[model samples]
Target: MASVNTLPGMAPTLAGKTAYVAICGLGMAADLADGLEAAGARVAIITDDTSCFASRSGVEAAFAAVAERVGPADLVVHAAASRALCGAQKLTSFGEAGFRCADTALRATLYALQAAHGQMAGRGGAIVVLGPAMSLVGASNLVPLVTATEGQRALVKSGARQWGRCGITVNWLAAVSELFAAELAGMDPGGPELGEACALGRRPQWAMDIAPVLAFLGSDAGRSITGASINMDGGEWMTP
Candidate 1:
């Protein structure tokens, strides 16, 4: 594979590595797969199209099949969270959609982490969970998504602590919505301005801005860094 520079001074950090990306249908997932491949990591996609995320056993079996096809993965990227946008009403509304959304996002992520951990038990690897930064700042109509993403962040920290001895590193990347620009275009004329809300006064470049961070976390360079949340949403939200 031809080596491409994923970041300055990195020299193809993922060279010769194998990455298994879940939820390939998402724009972020597709970008991640492409970026990983460009950096010399062989990529394999795992999605619900062929597997069910409704149960732990199903998720485990799906990952097992992927492992059989790709040998052992050096990095597992879990980008399977729900992207359904709903208002606060949905949070308090008596409906199964909210429950199902949370179930798919949180449960699927947990199962992916477990499956990856099991596969890399003795030998170590990296697990990157892609989440929304909106969870950090909180949004009016995204309660369920925020709950699941924040919960996933907490799980990453716990997983890092639990699996440190096994050499596994778990981290979360909080990204801006890939649809930010398009959504802004459809915003009401009287709505708040997107640029003014962000300190940087601009939205982040969807995949290009995030892929390098993933490459670093999945590489040996980031072995010392784990149990952390890296905010990749430009200056939308700041944390000390």
Candidate 2:
């Protein structure tokens, strides 16, 4: 039911490519994996939230094992939700726990990049970070998640700039988190009101609206777009 294989015309031929789906949340990770697989990439999924935040060596080891089990990763799609529901805290109530939530997100992202770079550095590949649309527009009661979202965005740009010479592209795709059911809310909270729809006048469908975009980004056609923060919010939140 995901969007990857349902698209018309020639699908991206990621033949012989090894891709990693690293996610903290479970909403669309399975669908995304199916999408990549439909496009011909050998996919490995890393859903262990604790391994990434625990220590440097652990993440490196975990990632290395995956590459060995499958093959060196040619692409990585990441979404950060490192803890159980790391969002929806009132600003006045924000505390050390809030900071820890933010830290987990940042730490997970950095590890993803570091591990992906270790594998893709000399070989050259793509790294796509999935973010929450609310990060583009501030959301109430989600200050920490927002902070981590933007922080990850900065990392994307930095990785793009530094890794461009190596043929590695880093970009962030801000999706409509509402579509992922309850699984993605920890990363993306405070969605629009019932009446507040996108410019397109509706919420995006995962298979119909969003998955196709990821298919494109993971393909060779999207090589030119790097260090970009694209909001696929059904135009609900337009970037000014």
Candidate 3:
């Protein structure tokens, strides 16, 4: 893990780099960790929804796998239990339960940001939050998620402004997909809708496709870019 492992022609962008934090604990985060390691950067900590971890334990196990390759991280990515996309109508209909859900998402992101910023105080590092496009483009049922995700975006901007001086870059990536089974998918409030809403007749993005952008944001190539929401959704939304 310490050695600079590169292919015959593949250059290392994060080679010998140190420190990174991953929140959400999804397949994307796992892929990001792999990309970072391949670039020679080591992940320091990871956090995710505890229930999700407890349900399958695969998420936590992924972090453990990374630790085996690289050294331990300082902070974990603890994600707050919240949906990805909450519509405006849903927000209106949301009672205490809705607020709680939204709060979880907001608090999770904030906690991760706080932890990562604190760890990077002296030496400096990178922080990437896994976000969805609906967070920026709010729909009817995406109220709770929209509220929380909006706050997260704002936090990213503020973090960049406040932490850039410390050499810590704060950024996030948004992926668009109808096939994702996460609660934040925003396609339905009932069950997972794999591909019933695609007007363009294209397959939803796989988690792997978005990993590189996140890796870039966590790498040297994204040093100058902070407090920005980079989208990895193939032409889904581009208002950012």
Candidate 4:
């Protein structure tokens, strides 16, 4: 997919920062990586053997392999998520799949936070966790995925509360389904129109829309922001 241009008012100012992005294989991941790089942040991609989120040791090992490269990372974005989309009946028929999906999404996030926390223990830094916008607006055939994404949001909040004293901030970013090909394919054809569903009245620009948010969260500008869920779906789901 072609990379979208950075949005107006979003410039590259993360010159000496290092960002470690886990493997999610989504267009958003690539876009965020590109945006971070464009902002002058040294970007490191960690994709070696991170698929097995069920194994904590395995996940830790994967992060450990790139430990040196991720030294004191200024930003750690956990975009890796299981894309298993199934109907509610399918969830009941094969409960294991649901468990696996949750395990993959939640554990991978926990592991990433652990690794990033260790690196940013003394110093302050930002960690961004990506979730699907459907998690907030309950789409059909997406219970497992929604559970996992919403659970990760809770994790981000708890981590933010606990790690704030250590000068570490944790936040969640909810992106539209366009970023995830699988989720997009499974979306209901008769669903509400994007413009009608979102207050902004337009589909989101996956890369262009999310890159600046990631950059801001990873920069000092977002230091005071923690335990917050920033919706990147153009006001698709509002939270009071």
Task: Write down the TM-score of every candidate.
Answer: 0.84, 0.87, 0.69, 0.85
- Give each model's whole-structure lDDT: 0.70, 0.74, 0.54, 0.71
Q: Is candidate 2 or candidate 4 better by TM-score?
A: 2
Q: Write the per-residue lDDT of candidate 1 for residues 63-141, one digit (tens) a residue.
A: 8888788777889988655544333344566277877776667887888888888788999999998876667766554
* Model 2 regions more than 4 Å off: 1-4, 49-52, 184-195, 205-208
Clashes of 3: 15
* Residue 144 in candidate 3, Cα distance off native in Å: 0.3
Candidates in descending TM-score order: 2, 4, 1, 3
Local distance difference test, candidate 3: 0.54
Name the weakest run of 10 consecutive residues (lDDT summed) in model 1.
Answer: 187-196
Q: Which ten residues in a row have the lowest lDDT in candidate 2?
A: 186-195
Instruction: Give, for candidate 4, the lowest lDDT window spanning 10 residues.
Output: 187-196
Q: Model 4, 1-240: lDDT tens per residue?
A: 234334563576677888877754343556667777776678877653444544557656666666665555888888656654333334576468877766677777887788778778898899999877767766556667677778889999999999999999999888765455344444554454221376777756645667678888888888999999888877766753
Candidate number achieving the greatest lDDT relative to the actual structure: 2
Error of 3 at 23 (Å): 2.9
Task: State the displacement of the C-alpha of residue 69, model 2, in Å, after optimal TM-score superposition.
Answer: 1.7
Q: How many clashes in each structure?
A: 0, 2, 15, 0
Instruction: Give all candidate RMSDs, comma-separated.
Output: 3.6, 2.9, 6.6, 3.0
Worst 10 residues of 3 by lDDT: 1-10
Q: After superposition, how far is residue 167 of candidate 4 from its true place, in Å?
A: 0.5
